[model samples]
Every structure is written in structure tokens, then in C-alpha cells.
Target: MKIKSYLLIILIVISAVGLSVCSYIYTPAKYQEYSVGVDKEPVMAPMLKGASAGVFPWSPVEKQEDPQSLAKKDKVAETKPEAKIEVVEPKSFTKVDDSYFDDAVFIGDSRMVGLSQYCPEIDSRATFFAKKSLTIYNLQKDAWIDVENGPKETIFDALSKISFSKVYIMVGINEIGRGTNEGYRDAYADVIKRILEIQPDALIFINSTMHVTKEKSDGDELYNNGNINVRNAALFDLIDNQHIFYLNVNDMLDDGEGNLDESLSGDGVHLKGSCYEPWHQYLLFNGVVD
Candidate 1:
């Protein structure tokens, strides 16, 4: 009985020691670095199961984006649609025959000097009376005039000498400097009324006042070229009859710069021989040529 009791005591002590050693190796704190919970199963790699568990948790499998699918998305973004556009064209003026005049009267300021110098062929189908340094209505008495050669002549005094099939008039650059828009229109209408009173059957060609540079001198500044542009607009508004015509002769002469080139005129205001050449062609093309 004594021997049996001693053996039982030894067996109990060995079992307790074995349990303590197992607890230290597999306790929650031993695997705490890998976050393996007490109730959860630990995921140890096949090679690491025999060795001590590592200090990292098992990582999830990574997913990769497809390159071809990403490229297709980019291509769709680049292929966006464009907006549509439409183009429009402008209309042109009608052509007319111009051989009807026999005796013509050309009137205006210095610009008429160029008209007088154009070859006789231009007015050979007609006779011409061209006056320089003149205005539409006599500036002095503020009356309608058939001729305005200084302020002295009455309109009747100026009309006494001529009968015309056509009358070409280019005026108002001077008036715009001193007169209001309404004043220029009223005065020009009065002049046209008087001219028709004198030559009722004649065709009237109202020429545009030619363009000029912005003059710096005292003489030209008050009558700046912009004043002429204003008069041109006013003149365009008063055109009513088909027999009454508006010719933008400046289109044939301007270099686009406000000043007329010497090739166009020696004095920057008048048209020269070179300038007259294209104008003559235009007159011919438009049937204004004889």
C-alpha cells in the first residue's frame, strides 16, 4: 500500500509539469502577434506549421484590373461626337446696259478733276461740264443750285447754259463738316430737286465722296475724312428713284488705308492716270463707258 501511494504521487507531478509547458507554447498571448483568436483556427503555411507561427496574419488574394478593358474605356471617351456647322453665301447685284447718255454734266469738288481727265472715250457718248471746288447746294444763300461756283451765283444763273442726258454728282464731304446729318440730307435733296427741274429726263449718277486720310493740319482737321463717311451714309438713305443711281466709285480707287496713294492721285484727294485706268474699266464693265 505504501509503494502504490508513492508511485501515484510521482505520476500526478509529471502530468502537471507537462500541462504547464503545453499552455506556454499554445496560449492566446503566444499567437497574439498573428491575431489568431482563441476560438478561431490559425492559418499556418504548410512549411511554417512545423516551425513557430510567424508574426503576420494571412493576407487575402489580390485582384488585378484588365488592361484591355481600361484601354477600351479610354477609347470610348476619345471618340466623342462633334457638332455640325452650316455655311451661307451672299447675293450679287444685277447687271445693266449703260449706252443711253449723250451730253453729261459732272459736278463736285476737286474729285471731279479726275473725272474730267479720264479719256474722251468715257464720255464720248456724251458731252461733259465738270466743275471743281463746288458743293451740292450753294453754301452761301442756303439755296438749291444747278451750279455752285462760289456763293455769288443764283441757281438759275448756273443752269442757263446746259442741257444734259446724264448728270453725275459727287458732293457732301464739305457739308458734313459744317452741317448736321438732317441738314446735309435736306440740302442735297434741294439740289437734286433743282437739277431735275432743269433736266427732268436725264439719268442721275450720285457718286460717293472719295475717302481721304485723317488730316493733321488746321485746314483739314475740322473737315476730317470721317465727316465724309457720315455724309456717305446720309446720301445712301435718300436714294429713291431707279433713274437716280448710287455709284461707290471709291471701291475702284481706295488702297484700304484712308489716304489715296500717289499712283491713285498726286494730291491724295484726286484720282491719277493709273487710278483712272481701273475706273475706266469699271465704267466700261458697268456700261457707264461710251
Candidate 2:
């Protein structure tokens, strides 16, 4: 009986040792430590049979995210879309014709008046707003640009009532007698601003002041090329080389040495009827268009 009792006791001890070894090999603590060491989002682990046996309990384990996926997401967050910009193009013209002036208007001094008288047929295509010896200062005065047996109106008042697509201006010969080149330009610029205000879309052609006969320029200092060129330079600056144009009609009528051809003029100042044809032809070839 004593030997049998000893054997049973040894058998119970061996059984206890085997159960401890199995529990240590498959513990919940081991799996928990492995999940904690990884860098990732956490998730619940699947139930195990050992939990039903009361040997161990399973819980949540952290899952590691792919490095490449994280990197791609970060790159997308940093990128931005670019802004779009708009560009505008300016108009230019190398040549045109007389029909181009059908809706045009001319405003100026005696030279412009002479244009209507010498070339009435050509002048008929465009309306003339001109007078003898017209200056910027006197343009707004009453009765500057008048009509036949009708109530006279100021140039500004008359211009306010009308509009034109093309506005040609040549009125500085009288103005040169009074002010400096800068002063003349300021007055001219003011005139241009008002004209633009009234006729916003008009294609402006600022004709160069015609040079005098060589003998006439030699006779008077103020009426010479020295003063005329100075005034014309002011007009040139007003042109943007796009919207406004500086037409040198003198190219057709000038003697090539900065002097008006003596034969073209009877008074060394005004061009004769015969010479106006070339001036009209020059306008036909050089007029602006888009």
C-alpha cells in the first residue's frame, strides 16, 4: 500500500510538470509582446482554443502599414496645381485703301481746309472739321469750325455731338508760334484725350506738319524746320505704334531735304491743287488697317 501511494504521488507531479511546459510554450503574453514591438494600427486577434480551456486569453494586435503606401499619400498631400494666365495681341497694318476713310473724320487748321478745297473729290469720302489757322487754344472758341449760313458752334461742342471710326488730326502750325515744344505737346495731348473720350474706337492718324519751302524756312526762324520738327517729335511720342499712327504725308510732298517742294506750292505754305493728288495717293497706300 505505501509503494502504491508513492507511485501515484510521482505520477501526479510528472503530469503537473508536462502541463506547465505546454502552457509556457503557447502563452498569450508572447503574442502580445510581438504585436506591441511592431509599428502599425491596432486590431483584435482571432479567438484561440486555449482561451476556452482557460490556459490563456487572446486580445488586440497592432498591424504594420506598408511604407510605400504611406510615402505615396504624403507626396500627394504636398503637391499643388498651377495657375493659368491670359495673353492679349495688338493690331497692326502695312497698307490699306481710300474706302478705309469712308467713316473717317479730319480735324485741323488751314492745311486741312486746303485739303477740302484742292481735292474736293477725295475729301468727299470723309467729313472735314477744319478752319483757317486753327489752333488748340482757339478750337473751343465760338465759330471756329462753322457751316454755310448756319449758327456757328465751338469745335468741342460740334465734336461732342458726332462720332467717327477713324479720326485724322493735323493742327500745330499755328500753335508752334506761341508755346514751347513741351507746352505744345501738353495742349495737343489734352485735345487727344478729349477726342478719345468722345470717339473711343476711332483709329487716329496724326499727320506730320508739312515742311515749308526751303526759301520760306530760311526767311523765318519760328516758321522753320527747327520748330516744325520739334512739334512733330511731340506728336510722334503720342503714338503707341499700335493704336495711334504718325503719318508723314511730307514724304510725298517734301523735297527730300526736309523742305516742301517749291513747285508744289504757290505761297511756299499751301500745296497747289495739282500736288494734292500725290498726297492723296500716299494716304491710300499707308493708311492703317487690322
Candidate 3:
């Protein structure tokens, strides 16, 4: 009876061991997928969220990402940086000398005529295409200039015939009462454009119309300093400060009240012959080197 009891115990132990071996060998398809190379050592199963911790004890499962999200992240990482932009400022003016006007041309109305005649140093150095009643409105169209030893010719024709390094222009005074400020500015701009086409390399100086005397401005509404200022403001818009410039001679000639000094002019409109010396000096001091 004792031998039989021992044999039954041995059989039970062997059956338990055999069942454990079969359970491990015939693993489920899910477990078997991760059971590669299990003979060498126990292979760790992929850990998943809410999975039993007792099942896989080696490492945590890597979180899977959406293909679109992964692609977007890769795109962001590979993107190129934006390019930088550059800014440029307008050019500034510098002083020059008498030799600067050696190849220069002066173009305008009576004031420019006065400049050519009275400013003897400048008159000798620069060429002048000026007349008593010359208007920018007719400068390109009418024959206004008397070529020395030649017939009268349009300013445009004269400009086309000669080569000049610098061009000085001041002619809004005659145009004040004839047309709208817009029309005057457009005509003036057209003349500037034409001059540029003729002398592309020349440095252009747009001299502001000289202000009238306080007595003249108070008496005449059309030819007043206020009207001159409005026209000068329009001309100021055309300067680029590089190849083109705006020189306001009124700085030197005006009284504290913005009118031409009463002492500087014999007539209310025209400067005295003696005053032209200071005007020439203003031009000399305010010249651009290039």
C-alpha cells in the first residue's frame, strides 16, 4: 500500500511538469510573435498600456505616432530659415567750389538771367539758357533763348546741342498765376525728365523760387511768398537727394518772417544787383561734389 501511494505522487508531479512545458512551448500567436530567440534566453514581450506588469518586466513599449503627425514634425524640422531684407537711405549733399560750375548750365526765368549777368564769377564759368519772361510751361515748346551769334532756339534744342556736368533750374515764379499747382508741378516734372534724358550724367539742382518782399506779398495775392512756397513744396518732392537736389536760396535772402528782405531788392520782385553776390556765394557753398 505504501509503494502504490509513492507511485501516485510521482505520477502527479510528472504530469504537472509536462503540462507547464507544453503551455510555454505552444504560446498564443500574439505572444509567439514577440518570442523570437527564446531558446537562448527569455525574450521580453512588448509592454502595452493596461497590460499586466507581471507579463513583461524588461522595458516599456514605445508609443506609436500617427503617420501624418510624424510627417508634419519632419517637415517642420527640415524647413529653411527666412532670408533677411536690406534697407537703403537717401544720399546727403556736400560743399563744392567754383570749378564745380565750370561745366555747369543754368536754366530758368528772369531771376536766372539776373544770376547769369550779376554773378560775374558764375557767369564766366557756367552756361545760361535764361530770359526775362521764360516759363517752364513753354520752355520745351517755344524758342525762348537767343543763341549767341545764332537765331533764337528752344531750351530743349540748346540743351540737346551741349554737354554739361551740372544743371541748375529755378522757374516757378512765372508759372504761379497761369495754371493749377498740379499742372505747374507736372510741367516742371516733365521738363526735369526731359533734361535727364538729354543729360543723364548731370547732377540736377532744383533751386527754390525766391520769396517776394513783405510789401509785394501784402499787395499782390497771386505773386506772394505763400504761393511761391506752395510751388516750392511741389518742386521739393521731385528731389531724390542723390542725382537730384533742392536748394532753397531763401534761407540766406529771407527776412525772419519768410519774405525777401526789403533791403535786398530794388523792385519788390527782383533782387538788387549787389544781392546777387550773396546768391552766388549760397550756390558755391551748397554745391554737391558728385
TM-score of each: 0.53, 0.67, 0.71
- lDDT tens digits by residue: candidate 1, 138-231: 5324433434555545543455566776677777655656657877778877777777887887667788877764232124765655667677
Cα displacement (angstroms), candidate 1, residue 179, comes to: 2.1
Model 2 misplacement above 4 A: 1-90, 140-143, 147-150
Q: Which residue pairs show collisions in model 1?
A: 102-126, 103-127
Q: Which structure is stronger by TM-score: 2 or 3?
A: 3
Give the alpha-carbon lDDT of every model.
0.59, 0.74, 0.80
- Best model per lDDT: 3
What is the lDDT ranking, best to worst? 3, 2, 1
Model 1: ten consecutive residues of lowest lDDT: 42-51
Give the Å error, residue 271, model 1.
Answer: 1.9
> Using TM-score as the measure, which candidate wins?
3
Which stretches of model 1 miss by more than 4 angstroms?
1-101, 123-125, 139-162, 213-220, 257-262, 287-290
List runs of model 3 lying over 4 Å from the truth.
1-86, 148-151
Candidate 2 residue lDDT tens string, 80-150: 55566765464555666677778888888888888888876558788898888888677534466675688
* Model 2 Cα shift for residue 25 (angstroms): 43
